[model samples]
Target chain A: MTFGQAILEALESLNGNKMRSGLTVLGIVIGVAAVIAMLAVGNGAQATITGSISDIGTNLLFVFSGGMEGGPRGGPGGGRSGNNDRPLTLGDAEAIADPFAAPSVELVAPVIQGNGALTFSGENTTTSISGITPAYFTVRNMQVAEGEVINEEHILGRMSVVVLGPETAVNLFGHADGIVGETIRIEGQPFRVIGVLVEKGGGAFGSEDNAAYVPFTTAQARLIKRGALDEVDVIFVQAISAEAVPLAVEEISNVIRARHRTPIGYDDFTVFTQQDFLSTFETITGVLTIFLGGIAGISLLVGGIGIMNIMLVSVTERTREIGLRKALGARKRDILLQFLTESSLLSLIGGIIGIMFGWFIAFVVGQVAAATGNDFVPVVGVDAILLSTGFSAVIGLFFGIYPASRAANLEPVEALRYE
Target chain B: MDRVIEARGLTKTYKMGEIEVHALRGVSFEIERGEVLSIMGPSGSGKSTMMNTLGCLDRPTSGEYILDGESVAEMTDDQLASVRNRKVGFVFQSFNLLSRLTALGNVELPLRYAGIAEGRREKARAALEAVGLQDRMTHRPYELSGGQQQRVAVARALVNNPAIIMADEPTGNLDSKVGREIMNLLLNLNKELGTTLIIVTHDPNIAAQTQRVIRLRDGELDPENNETIVRKK
Candidate 1:
């Protein structure tokens, strides 16, 4: 028989038992939908994380006052390990800032952070306070939304003036705007509010809008003292361009190594570029995507088994019909093709519908994520769709082989006599 | 006479577990082209076995059997299928029409297996017309009466225009009136188309309508009951 005739026969048989065919197709539908939705969700999470990480200025390098003993650290104020490690000092930051010593370095902002409770009138909230210089805004991509930023005079005169991040401002005072001229007591010490930073969204290390900034000299002289008076916690180094990040890292590493009197490869500090963090996150998320897709593939396999089961039932039920066709001179290949076509057609139909259902699931997930103030959007790629549908079709054909062959190998006389 | 079938000492043996049952034992017969013949016997008389062998549905154990000038006894399964498609048509007692298809679709099945693509609908319609089922071409088996369903089967059998048509108790499911009508239809179609017809029946009245009758008492033909009827032209 021709392929067209086989298709027609398959369609008729499947139509004859609509309930059974529909139930069989539903198995594949759920399998494909799960695969697509799971994969899309995985991809979306990866995109959001990487997007936020890349948002943190790809040209910047972070230098911490510790050795590279543990795995790569995330954000600022990570753990410091090893007894041989020396604290990062303001002198090292100044040296790295010198254009002659580090040509690729555009700016360096030394930071000393401590947690302090700030009170405005009766309302009080505790948040991390960072001591930063004028270059901190440029290096960290921060902006002043109200009043003015800390100037050179504030650092030279050791003025007790502070800048609040948007979230911190909202917590201390009623709102971010018009809170510049207000005075807030930090650790029971009165400091005048100088400015409020613009709102920057959350990232890999949590929300950036939850801290307050003060002048570096004021913090070093009056607050946050660790080892030396000029000791700093971390230094934010800005490269001339994204391509110069490696050069900036090398120069900063050399300057710190020389200052700390450490041998090669045994430095007292660690320097990390944005690319390092990006690759680490990508590897983690890529594996997660595959793992989730693999789990969803199990359901697809179950769906294929469903197809096989239904096909077997159909073959047994139509034994007499098979005998009749054979008696009418139908070859073995014709019977095989007819049954295979039925199974494949069932799965193909299921695959198409599953794609739509999976897309809907992904869309709903994205909508829910956005509603909860999350910067996540599920991404359904064409490759995911194609992979699932093609895999389902192949699964149908593979599982159908046993039943179709069983039908084809039937003896005409015995099949006719089968009741 | 142009011979359409030649059976020389045809024998068929079956193994029912440890016991051997000889279904056909050295039965020999020759059928001329365009002749109407019948085989009549009671249960366990090897009448079904003879019909199966003559219809090319099964091979004899040890015999040289030829149908329409082709040796069919030693043909492979696929080759036998081809031979059945090209040379033999069958009308079953239960009217083995596909319930899902209409009369025309059932009639077109043989031509489809024969790989004839073009004019299939016309050829099927013509065969239905020949069987007086032209008006019932679009009716499914469930929608037609028993006689009409048998007529559709007859149309399907004749559509391929094979060398022989084998009817195994064609009128067994119908009442006497309907059975007589079906017998007359088969005999008339044989005379009109000059196609060799073989009917296996237990009814002597049905067998008497044919030009020749072969009677079997056991696995072998009974010569005493075997008779040829000469019909007045």
Candidate 2:
């Protein structure tokens, strides 16, 4: 018989026991629906998590000075920074600024921090004085919401200038409009505020808006006393091109090592690019998605097995029909195809309903989350739907085999005699 | 002068647990077209076995059975089903019409299997009309009388336009008057279609009506192979 004919026949035969057929197909529907919903949700969470991480700044790289490994694990003194005998000083920072070797290198800053109590009017608040270059604004993509950032001339001429963070300007000046060209006292010294950073809602917890930026020359010459402790805290390198960050990091590490004349395995620093940071978040979120999907997959497996069991029962129940079909010139392949088609159709129908339900559920969850002020959205994409639907079809095909074969192999006479 | 049924050294042995019971001995015979042949036997005489083997439902143990210049004894299962669909139609005693279908649908089944195109419904209606069931075209099997169900089966058998109509005790379940009516229907079909008809029964009275009668006793052919096909194993 033709495929259309066989399909119609199979469907017509189901009406013989309507209730049983409905109940049996219900299991497949539930299974396909669950598989689609869980997979879409899992995929949605992965996209949201990764997008949030990337928003922080994929171009930002982090390097810490007091890292372990080469410093702590070394038998003797190794790198200049970690050793008690050798310290990372201004000279080591200067060597990484060889512009001829790294033409794309834009700015390099040596960072030093000191905390002091500030007195402006009756308010005495303590805050960290961050020493950085004028180019630090460019490196960090900071938008100025005031008069202007300190220029490169100010750093060279040792001019005393300051920039207020968003929260600091709000707290110190109490101007709801804007804080610009304002003076705030720092450690019994008066400094002119030149700029204010645009307000950025703080990440996770602590507010980045509550900090302040001042040129390194001013901080070293006027505010903090230069004691015998002239140790540099860290080095920030900005590449001229974002694509050069990895090579820049590699070369910077090498230049620092050469400048320090460090021994093997005792370097007290870690150099990492933005991609490393991104991958760290990727690993974490990827694992989370797979774990959740694995749990959902268990249920899918149970559903497939359930279908196999029901198909087996159907083969036995329809033994006479199978015999009659065989007697009417149906090939073995025809019988197999008929049973397989039924299973796949059941799964396909179930998956479509499940996908629609899942998308709606995910959308509702995103709306509720945004309502709660999280500002996060759930994303369900075409790839997830295709993956889940394809998997459902594969599950049906694999599980539909045994019963189809059994039906195809029955002896006509014995089947005809079935009670 | 085409012999529609010819068997040479046909044998069929059935295994019943640890013992082998011979269903048909080495017997041979032939029957021509348009003839009504009957096989009459007592119980355990292997008449059903012979009927099954002839119907391509079971293969003979060791034999040469030829039908219309084709070797049915060596045909594949699908080939046998093809022969059944194209050349042999069956009418059983209990009326093996599919119960889920209406009368029209039941008659259309064989043609459906044969992949017949449009107008199957009209043709099935015509078949039902011929069976004297035109008004009952939409009735299911359960709603039909015992005799009507058998008539639907007859319509199903003729729908494919096969060469022969094979009936196994066609009136065994009916009363004498109803049985006679069924017999008349079969004779009418033969007269109209000129189909070779084979009937198997235990009744000698039914056997006497056939143009030729073959009898089996204890799985062996009776002294009747002179005119009828006697299949033995």
Candidate 3:
């Protein structure tokens, strides 16, 4: 029989039982929707993680002297560089900051660190102190929410000045504005709060909003009490131009290594630009999203197997029809193609509806999330929608073959005689 | 004789799990074009086997059978199907109208196999009208009476304009009055269209109405050893 006739007949059968067909289609819809929705959320979370890591700019670089690995106690002895103690120092940052020395380099900031009990009106809490030069604010995108930023005078005089991050200011001083120009004690030494930092939002590790900043030299002298010989904790540097970042980093690394006198492989310190952190974060989030979405895609397999099962039932139910068509001169491929087309159509219709429904659901979820807080929830987009719908179609086309071929290959006499 | 169907030394043996049963044995016959032939026999006379062989729905175990210079013995099943679909049309005892399709749709079935598109609806309407089922074209098989359903089946058979019409008890499931009506429709096609027709039936009255009757008993022709076969009225 003509393929058109066969297809029309199959469609009529599907149309005859509307509810049953709709319910069958519903299976595919749910499968595709779940896949899209899960992928959207995963992508959203991944963007957030990567955004937090490199929001400052890829041209910015950081050198943290001590992380999980602890460095030497007292410096300028026999360090990993054979000049001793922890590797980096303020001199290395000053060396790179020299304009005529490396014109491609822009700003550099020395950093030191200490942690102790911070007190405000007898409300004591443990707080970390980050000692930073004046350029640290611009390099890390930290703005002064109130009062003045740490200036050269604070560093030169070794003044007891401090900047409170938004979270710390609110917790101790009651009002973020109240914290500016107030005195707080860190390890029983009083430091004047000169500025409050802008809110930097949450990150994978912790809230960037929670911390205190002070002049590098004052912090080094008062709290840390380390001499010029102590290894530098960190140095923040920004490239002279965004385009020149890679070259600038390479030159800085060369200059730093020459100062420390260390071989490349066993260098005691790590230097990486913000872009490196961003890409690393992106890779991590991408993998996490795929893993989550892959688990959600299991439903498609279940739905596809369901189609195969129903098709097998249909073949048995219409064995007589198969026989009649065979007797009327239908080719095997005609029958096969007819059944396959029917299955694919079923999935396509289901997928279309599912994508719309999934988007609606994701929108609703975003609305609910927005109600709770101001966080923007990620949702289904073109790629997710197309991928899911196409996935459903592929599932149908892929799984629909066996039963269709079985129906097509039936012996006319055998099928005719089947009760 | 302008022989359109010729059977020589035809034998069909069926295997039912190691027990062989002879269904048609050494039966030989020839039918010329435009002949109205009826096969008359009781149940188990192997008449159904002969009908199946004639329809090319089953193959012979040992035979030399030819249709219009083409040997049926060597023809593949697909080739046989092509011959059946093109050269012959079938009307079943049960009216076999595919219960789902209307009268016109049923009549349009063979045309579908023939790949006759472009105004097939008009052709199917015309064929149904020729069977006197023009008013009943929209009625499904169940909606139509037995006589009407048989007429629809008859229209399906004629729509292809095949070389021969094979009806296996065309009125087997009908009442006596409706049976006569269906038989009259068959007879009219034979008379008016001069179409070759073969029918299998146990009714002597129906067999007597045909131009020729071939009696089968126990898988062979009755009272016969190389008997003369001829058209009679």
Candidate 3 differs from the real structure by a C-alpha RMSD in angstroms, to one decimal, of: 3.6
- Residue pair clashes in candidate 1: none
Candidate 1 differs from the real structure by a C-alpha RMSD in angstroms, to one decimal, of 2.2
Q: What share of the true interface contacts does each candidate keep?
A: 0.63, 0.44, 0.40
- Per-residue lDDT of candidate 1, residues A156-189 (tens digit): 9999999999999999787889987788998888
Please report, as a residue range, the 10-residue window in candidate 3 chain A with the lowest summed lDDT. A72-81
lDDT of each: 0.89, 0.72, 0.78
TM-score of each: 0.95, 0.81, 0.90
Instruction: Using TM-score as the measure, name the better of candidate 1 and candidate 3.
Output: 1
- TM-score of A-chain in each prediction? 0.96, 0.77, 0.90
Query: Looking at candidate 3, what TM-score does chain B attain?
Result: 0.93
TM-score for candidate 1 (chain B) = 0.97
Off by over 4 Å in 2: A14-31, A56-58, A66-98, A109-134, A144-234, A264-267, B118-122, B138-143, B172-181, B202-209, B222-233
- DockQ (Cα-based) per candidate? 0.75, 0.43, 0.48
Model 2 lDDT tens row, B1-233: 77888888778887889999888887687878878889878888878887877777778888898876678988887787777777777888878777878988878877776778688888888888878998999999999988888898888888777777888899998888888888888888888888888899877777767887777776677875434633320
DockQ class, candidate 1: medium
